[model samples]
Structure formats: structure tokens, C-alpha cells
Target: MLYDITHRTTYGYGSDVSVAHHLAHLHPRELPSQQISDFKLSVEPAPTVNTEHVDYYGNTTTFFTIGNPHDRLVATARSRVRITPPLLPNAARTLAWQQVRDRCASDVLTPDSEVGEFRFDSPNIARRPVLADYAAPSFPKDRPLLEAIVDFNGRIFRDFKFDSRATTVATPVDEVFKKRRGVCQDFAHLAIACLRSLGLPARYVSGYLETLPPPGKARLIGADASHAWFSVWCSGHGWIDADPTNNILPGDRHVTVAWGRDFSDVSPLRGVVVGGRGHSLGVSVDVARVAE
Candidate 1:
């Protein structure tokens, strides 16, 4: 499947007088199951300097600076990409969850271990006994890794309510667990925390999920929103992505953008402004399918 994606971000400030700098992670990733054909990013006020590079996690990072003063800012990214469904291993045939956790733990002692990096705490996700306890039911004695992860993902979908107003980006994982309600970000974070607490290697995935409108309703432009999901490492399978908010494994409809320990590492757009204050943010995303 091929798709064209548009992501637009607008910021209005109470007052502005000076410079601004921004960093963006809006470029679609080129993966075995996904290919990026084209990508373009445009910034308003005409940045004095604009550049891009791949980050430590292999995500395309765009950085730009606006020297002139402006009360408003707009950054938009457009891309064309093709996606194929990823092959997944049989959940019941994979190694036991405990074995994967033990291997990850042993591997963490090695210096510069890549997989070990995600098995620990980050700014947005922390391992706690409560999280381990919450995840306990899904992981029984010698349960297969992928099978257990699927059960945990489904449990999160059934237990939590998808209330946009229930939490913010800064909300803690324990709080989300307590309230049993939050948007996609919260659920993804919650799942990561739980898995990390169990000593498993997991990472956060940032991307877009294609959504369909009602039976007779026309698809609204910019109706799609950014999506978040989690991935767990299976010994022979590498990383397998799962969506707890929707309780399914990620496939062709999911576009990969960036990934890291948590959301803070791969925020679609974030920055520092020299003079802008009392800012309000608006974001819209459209993911349209292309017929062959």
C-alpha cells in the first residue's frame, strides 16, 4: 500500500520579539516493510538555518532556526511512502518470556549494549513494582514472549478508557494505571513501563495510524492524528510492534516515523523559543491512501 501524509503544526504566541529554534521528527522511516519515496519540510518565517541529520536512534531529525521575530510559526511535513505488512512469528512458538527477560538482563551488563538501553528507565517511563504486578497476570510461568505480550496488550485495551481529556503528556504511568483512562500516548507509555518492570527489552514507536470514517461519511481532511505503540524484542524475531490502544499488531496501515525509550525521544515536533510566551499549539494530520 502507498500513502501520502501531511502533518502540520501551528503555534500562536501571546507575544513575540526575537529568535526561535525547533527540532522535528516528522520524516517517515525507511524500513524493511516500509519505503519512503519522497519527503519535504517547510517552515514559515523563512528559517535562517535549516538542516537535518539522523539521530542516535536512527530517526531523521530536522533542525531549523528563525532569526527574525514572528508572533506565529508553522512547520509542515509532507511525505509519500509505501508499506507492506510485516511478517510476525507464531506467538506460541517464540521463546518463553522469562528467557527473553533473562537474556536482556545478562546483555545489559555489556558496555554499549543497544538492546539494553531500552530495558531501563527514561524520562517518560519508569520501572516500578506496581507495574510488574499489573503485568503479572498476562505473563504466566514459561509463557511465550510474543504470546504474553499480546495478552498484555489486549488487557490494556480492555481495561483503559480512551479519554483524551484524562491525561497530558506529563502524566505519570502509575497515575494512568490508577485512572484506567488516557489517550494512545498514555497507553503506550503504560505498556512500556510494565514490560520494562518485567525486565524485558521494549521500545516506543511513534507514527500515524490510518483511520476510516463512518459508512456514509466522507473522510475529513486532517482528521487523522499521530499514533503511538510499543515493540518487544523476541530472541529470533527482533522487534515486534503492538498497539495496546487498538489491541493489534502493527501492519501496513501503520506508518513508522521514529522510536526510542519513550515519547520524549521521538516527539513529532518540539523546540525552544527565545521570546514567544503563553503559546497555544494546534496540530493536524492527514494520511490518505493511494490506489495502484
Candidate 2:
């Protein structure tokens, strides 16, 4: 499968900005299952300084500085990607949850060793007793890791409400637990927190999930939004992506942009501005399947 993705972000500042610096993880990642054949970033009022480099997590990042004052900033990224993923392994056949957890803390370092760092606190997710209490029901003493993960994911999807207005990027996992309401981001964070509470390695994944409209309805232009999910480390299988928002394992429909300890590490965009009273932001993402 192949896809053409376009993501556009527009910002309107109440006051003109004299200078700004920004970072973006808008470029798609290249993996055996997915390839970023080509990518480009377009900025209105081209920046005075720009540079690209890979971050600590091996994610492609672009840093740019704008010197001229402007009341608006728009960033558009276009990319072509190819994906051909193998079928997911049977969840029940995977290692037991405790075995995976034991491996993460051991001194041995497999290629999947780096995943150990994710089993702790991050800006958005922290280790809390409540999280573990909420998640314990899914993982009995001898449950398979993936099976437990899938069940936990479904629980979140069933118990929570997908309300866009319920939370913000800054919302805490604790708040989401109380309200049981949030968009994909909150669910992802909530799950990440739950896993970490159990001393398991889990990380946040930022990406786009191809969404389809009703059977007879026309696809809405730019109606789709960027999505979030979490990945857990399995001893032999490596990282497995789980989507609590949709209660499914991610595959061809998932386009990974970046992964990190939490949303703060892989935020699509973040920056410092010299001047700007306040701002309103709008974002639209479209993912279209292309013929092989």
C-alpha cells in the first residue's frame, strides 16, 4: 500500500511577532514496514534560518527561525509513503506479561534493550498507584503481553468518551481518568501511564490513522486529524503498537511520524516566540491511499 499525506497548520497571532523558532516532526519515518519515499515542508514567509537533524529518538526534526515580524504563520508538509506490513503475530502466543517485564529490568541488553528507558515517568505520563490499580484487572498473573495489552486497550475504548473538547495537550492523565473523556491523545497518555505504573516499558506514538466516512457520505476535505497511540516492548517481538482509541492493532492504516517517551518528546510542533500576545491554532490532516 502507498499513501499521500498532507498536514497543514495555521496560526494567527493577536500581535505581530518579531522573531520565532520552531521544531517539527512532520516528516514520516522509514521502516521495513513503511518508507518515506519523499517529503517536503513549506513555510509561508520562509524562515531566515533553517536546519534539519535527527533527534535522540532517531526521529527526523526540522528547526527553523523566523526573524521578520508577522501576524500569521503557516506550515504545510507533503509526503509520499509506501507501506507493506506483515500480518500481526497472534497475541496469545506471545510471551507472558511478567516475562516481558522481567527482561526490561535485567542487565542483558538485546537490540530491544533501549526500550527500557520508557518504563518511567515523562512529562505527560507518570507512575501512579491509581493507574496501576485501573490496569491490574486486565493483566492477571500469567496473561500474554499482547493479549493483556489488547484487552486493556478495549477497556479504555469502551469506558471513555471521545470528546474533542474534553481535554488539551496539557491535560494530565489523572484528569482523564476522572472524566473518562478525551480525544486520542488523552487515551494514549492514559494507557502509557497505566503500563508504566506496572513497571512496563511503553512509549507514545504520534502518527496519522486513515479514517473513513459513512458508507454513503462523501469524504470531508481536511476533516481528519493527527492521531496518537502507545507501543509496548515485547522481549522477542520488539515494540507492538496498540490503539486504545479504536481498540485495534495498528497496521497499514497507521502512518508513524515519530515516537518518544511522551507527547512532549515528539510534539508535531513546538517553539519559542519573541513576541505574540496570544494565538489561535488550526490544523488539518489528510491521508489518502494510493495505488501500488
Candidate 3:
């Protein structure tokens, strides 16, 4: 499957007087199952300095600065990407969850051993006993890692309500656990915290999910939204992406952009402004399939 994605962000300031600097992670990742054909980023007001680099987590990061004063700012990213359906690892064939956990903690350094970096707490997600308790039911003694993860993913999908108004980007994972309601970001954070509590390695994935319009309805220009999911590190197989929001392993319909310990590490756009005060942010995203 091939897709064209457009993500636009606008910031209207109550008052503005000086410079602004921004960072973005809107570039789609090139993976074995995904390839970016084209990408472009345009910023209104024209940045005086613009640069791009790969982050610690291997995600593309962009930095731009606007030296002049402006009351409004707009940043837009457009891209074309191709995706092949992922070949899911056989859950039953994976090592037992406990073994994978213990081995990940061991000092032995293999090519994939670096995944241990994700086994601990990060800025936006912290391991807690309660998170382990929530995960305990899905993972039994000696259950295969991937199999248990699949069950846990499905449980989250069934238990939580997708309420966009329930939480904000800064909502605590524990609070989401208590409320049992949140958008994809909350669910992904909750799941990552749960996995980390169990000594398993997991990371947050940021991306776009192709959304189809109702049967006879015309597709809206920007109805689709940015999506979030989590990935668990499986020995030998590497990271396996799972969508607790939709309760399925990610495939061709999912277009991965960036990933890290949590959302903060891969936020699509974040920055500091020198003089802009009380800003209103507006975002619109469109993920449309293209004819192969």
C-alpha cells in the first residue's frame, strides 16, 4: 500500500514580538516494510535557520528558527510513502515472557541487546507496581512473550474507552488506568508503563493510520489524525508494533513516523518561543491511500 500524508500545524499567538525556534519529527521512517518516496516541510515566515538530524533513537529530527517577529506560525509536512504488510512473528514460537525479561536484564551484549535501554522508565512513562498488577492477568507463568502481548493488547482495546476529552498529552498513566478512558496516546503510554514494570522492553510509536470514510460518504480533507501505538522488543525478531487502540498488530495501513521511550521523545512538533504569548494550536492530518 502507498499513502500520501499531510500534517499541518498552525499557532496563533495572543501577542508576538520576537524570535521562535521549533523542532519537528514529521518525517516518515524507512523500514523493511515501509519506504518514503518523497517528503517536504514548509514553514511560514521563512525560518532563518533550518536543519535536520537523526536523534538518539534513530528518528529524523528537524530544527528551525525564525528570527523575525510574527503573530502566527504555520508548519506543514507532506509526504508519500509505500508500505508492505508486516509479517507478524508467530506468538507461540517466541520465548517465554519471563525468560525474555530476564535475558534483557542480563549483561550479555548482543546486537539486539540495546533494547534494554527501553526496559526502564522514561520521561513520560514510569514503571509502577500497579501497572504490573494490570498486566499480570494477561501474562501467565511461562507464556510466550508475543502471545502474552497479543492478549494484553486486546485487553486494553476492550477495557478502555476512546475518549479524546478524557485526558491531555500530559495526563499521567496511572490516572488513565484509573479512569479507563483516553485516546491512543494514553493507551500506548499505559501499555508501555505496564510492560516496563514487568522488565520487558517497549517503546512508543508515532504515526498515521489510514482512515476510511463511511460507506457512501465522501472523504473529508483532513479527517484523519496522528496515531500512537507501542512496540515490544522480541528477541531475534526485534521490535513488534501493536495497536492497542485498534487491537491489532500494525500492517500496511499503518505508516510509522518516529519512535522512542515515550511521546515526548518523538513529538511531531515542539518548540520554544521568545515572545509569543498565549498561543492557540490547530492541527489537521490526512492519511489517504494512493493507487498502486
State which candidate has the highest lDDT: 3
* Model 2, runs deviating above 4 Å: none
lDDT tens readout by residue for model 1, 1-292? 8999999999998798498888999999999999999999999989999999999999999999999989999999999999999999989999999988877777455422458668999999999999999999999989999989999999999999999999999999989999999999999999999999998888999999999998999999999999999998888779899999999999899999999999999999898888866899999999999989
lDDT (Cα) of model 1: 0.92
lDDT of 3: 0.94
What is the lDDT, from 0 to 100, of the residue 79 in candidate 3? 97
lDDT of 3 by residue, 51-113 (tens): 999999899989999999899999999999999998888899998999888888888897456
How high is the lDDT of residue 13 in model 3? 89
Tell me how far the alpha carbon of residue 48 in candidate 1 is from the true structure, in angstroms, after superposition. Answer: 0.5
**TM-score for all predictions?**
0.97, 0.97, 0.98
Residues forming the 10-long window of minimal summed lDDT in candidate 1:
105-114
Which 10 consecutive positions of candidate 2 have the poorest summed lDDT? 105-114
Clashing pairs in 1: none
Tell me model 2's lDDT, rounded to 2 decimals.
Answer: 0.91
Worst 10 residues of 3 by lDDT: 106-115
The model with the greatest TM-score is 3
